[model samples]
Target: MKDIQTHDRQRLAEKLRFLEPDVIEVITTNFCQQHPETKEPGEVDTTHCITDARYHLTFLRTAIEFGTEETFRQYLRWTTKVLQTRNIPHHVLQRFLEEIFHALEPHLTDSEKLVVRTHFLDVPESGLTERQTPARSESPLALHQEVFLQALLAGDRHAARTIALEALSSTHSLSDVYVEVFQESLYKIGSLWESNRISVAQEHVATAITQYVMANLYTCVTPSQPSKGKGIITGVEGELHQIGSHMVADMLEMQGWDIRFLGVNIPHQAILQLIKEFQPTLVGISATMVLKVPIVRDLIKDIRNHFPSAATPRILVGGSAFRALPDVYRDIGADAFAYDLRTLTTLLS
Candidate 1:
């Protein structure tokens, strides 16, 4: 029964994807006609409405593909807070969601419409209260993490690098810096962006600073022993979040693995060609967005098809996607899913 619902949702998502442009147009037109106040200068204009409609549909499609409303619900909750922070009235958000549902109605079957309506039934109410600071981690390097995060938020690359290097020089190991500082800080930055506590530009700046800091710290990471095995780490296609993958590659290299870190959004053919040339012992794929899990699954399938069972590299998956659905890797035929660097190294060992 569950599998049948999942299939229906998948089909619905695919259909919506095909009709995205038309659906978005209908949503924008209806929203404008229903709310003329939004068309005023400096208000939510047609362009903004179109963009929001696209994102709304995209998030809904992802939720359907996941076979759970939790994904869409979470996005709606975050968006509600963000809109409230921007002084956009709560009613406008509600109206936008309603417009989306009506726009999609013409394209969906009665059953599919019911599934979509379920996703919209419990819209989150907006709150005007200020977002509280995220709680501090209990890690010993918590202080360093806090300082590093503030530095990144402030766009002080030098301070961020110095904090990371200083922590590495102290009693803290490279793993501590990566996990307790970099990973934790990035997570907090994501939360801030979702809550509208910080702008997207600020979040990008923080990520860039962290990447810079990681590069500087790489100079200090020397393997103490011979190579354990060859490995390739990359983000799945269309996945722009590569910092976590980069950290995994660096840690693996430090563990005496021959690591090749291919950047994000790599093509399937490119990955296969690399596998043929490199013949790695392990291939680590990262997909930060839950929506990209299907792409990861397909990539894994391609790898299996192109290589004999005995020749295929041990496929390991990770990132934020698997954090919520830890067993999904097994479902996708991946050999393993690592939540963090320690788990990954432990699995390899």
Candidate 2:
């Protein structure tokens, strides 16, 4: 691969930030085909597509297991469309299916690459099965998000997601739920996934279901409330995680700050450009994988260099990677380590 240009790298990182597996493959195939080397189903392009496909696929698998079907189906259509048109490689497709639906692989019972192989035959048959009866599980919600989520978890994701939508709509602000209600629920779900009580797919399902409900609520948000200070949060060039930043954006928004969410896998230059353009009060960086830690440190250093003329926005760092080495925050020259959303209350204060 060529030395990726700074802006284009960020664009690629952001382009398919949260795409499902099938969609990522579709995108990779299209992207590879657009380039000279990747046009054919060669081994090199196949490898690249496979790697990228897993990122999208794993997330979707998690979502399907935990989130509402409404959320799963919403993106399912988009993914299916991409699969239908994009010329993805065979083995790569199989690998993606294997990762997401691991348990089902054994059930293939001697069939030759049965799992993803069949799904690969046609894009439309990507198994976005809405008609399958969800087992009745949760109590119907007259009000409360608890009831909604309980219902959602119980197999009536359609109803759960719908109620969540109503709850989000009733909120005076799009960001209102994040501080306590949403954050707490997210943490609980994470715990469930971590404890092995729920699978990664289930966690993903919950996030997808919640995100869809939130997206609808966000659209209705309309920024009716007046703004305060502005901020931007992004993952460094090589990093792909965006969950922590989502929390920051919501917290800042709830606190009346105008936040610009540049999103996952953003490059140093793009962030710098936004900083220069928006003149935000703080710049937040999130890194989920430890291997990407240097990217975060370097990005902060670069941002510091670019804003020499005035008060550089405070740099904030957070994510799983930082959990082990909280001291790294100081070494990296970040002004704040937003270890939690509440940390911002003090920093922004």
Candidate 3:
């Protein structure tokens, strides 16, 4: 095997720059105080923090390698420790537990893992007569892989790049592992939230981690074009929840969109100027939260007013918040609302 390098360590260091200087310092101090032998303890703090994000869960092989029945059980029992801390909320702890356990259960012994799945994970053993069984192929996930996730959760940008390079060298790209495995892991986080097995704060921890994790992924992949792929995609003013937009951006670029991604919080006049500047073949807007409807409506109006030549470059609206209020689209006035990335691709060029 090729030697593991400092790329992961560096990611942790860079991410520390974004954190509360004191929080990073404290984590470093604590990690050093705890494990001094590791010369690169700076990044280790991020790796340590992400275990709670449940990166271990989706990549079952990784979880099986780093996770223990003991750790898994403790995550399940996070409320006790959190309660003792007296600072964190109960839901926060619950979300941490749910994500890790859901992803790991498929690899764990049926009897032990099933207990939580039956009670949580949103999948019932009694329901699916045909379920996937664990395999050796599913085990042996690298420590660096789990560490990369931790780094991203902790906002350790350097660690993100480092582990990403490490993964890339091993006959696979991070995207090779990311698209399906990690996506499923995130789905588990959402499933836990929708089911009430985990608390909202816990869900936010996972969501925050998941969102930033994608941000980290952007750093690893070299940009073929500065504006995403080669074109442009954006959301309306006040519509943020770039998660859905990011996914669509990735998928669209893969399908040759030459992407220009204008992430959430864009305003009306700004978008009009952007439309004129970029002259994109298509315009995609994502609305994951509710308040974006008005912003989107205004965006459509401005697009027509300024770029009347383009008329409509396939306006698209997506995300859970928009999906929840399909009725609002009549008021907002978009050409289409996509359920997922593939559908969005079909709707546009």
lDDT by residue (tens digit), candidate 3, 1-349: 0021234322322332333234434434444344433222355444544432323232222112222223333333432343333344444434444544543434455544543344334332232222344653542334555665456445555655566556656666544545443454555566555445667686666556656656666565664433433345677666645666777776666555577777777776777777677777667777754434545667777776666554446576777645555544554556678766556656654
lDDT of each: 0.83, 0.57, 0.51
Better of 1 and 3 by TM-score: 1
Per-prediction tally of clashes: 0, 11, 16
Regions of model 3 farther than 4 Å from truth: 1-179, 191-205, 215-231, 309-311, 326-331
- Cα TM-score per model: 0.88, 0.51, 0.45
Per-residue lDDT, model 1, residue 151, is 100
How many clashes (backbone atoms < 3 Å, residues ≥3 apart in a chain or on different chains) does model 1 have?
0
- Candidate 1 residue lDDT tens string, 1-349: 1354656767888998998998877876678666654453576457766777788888778667766565566667666776665667777877787777888788788988887786554464533233465975498888999999999889999999999999999977898899999999999999799777898899999999999999999998776464698999998779998999999998988888898899999999999999999999899999987778889999999999999999999999999888856767886889999999889979988
Better of 2 and 3 by lDDT: 2
The alpha-carbon deviation from the true structure for residue 256 of candidate 3, after best TM-score superposition, in angstroms, is: 1.9
Best by TM-score: 1
For lDDT, the strongest prediction is: 1
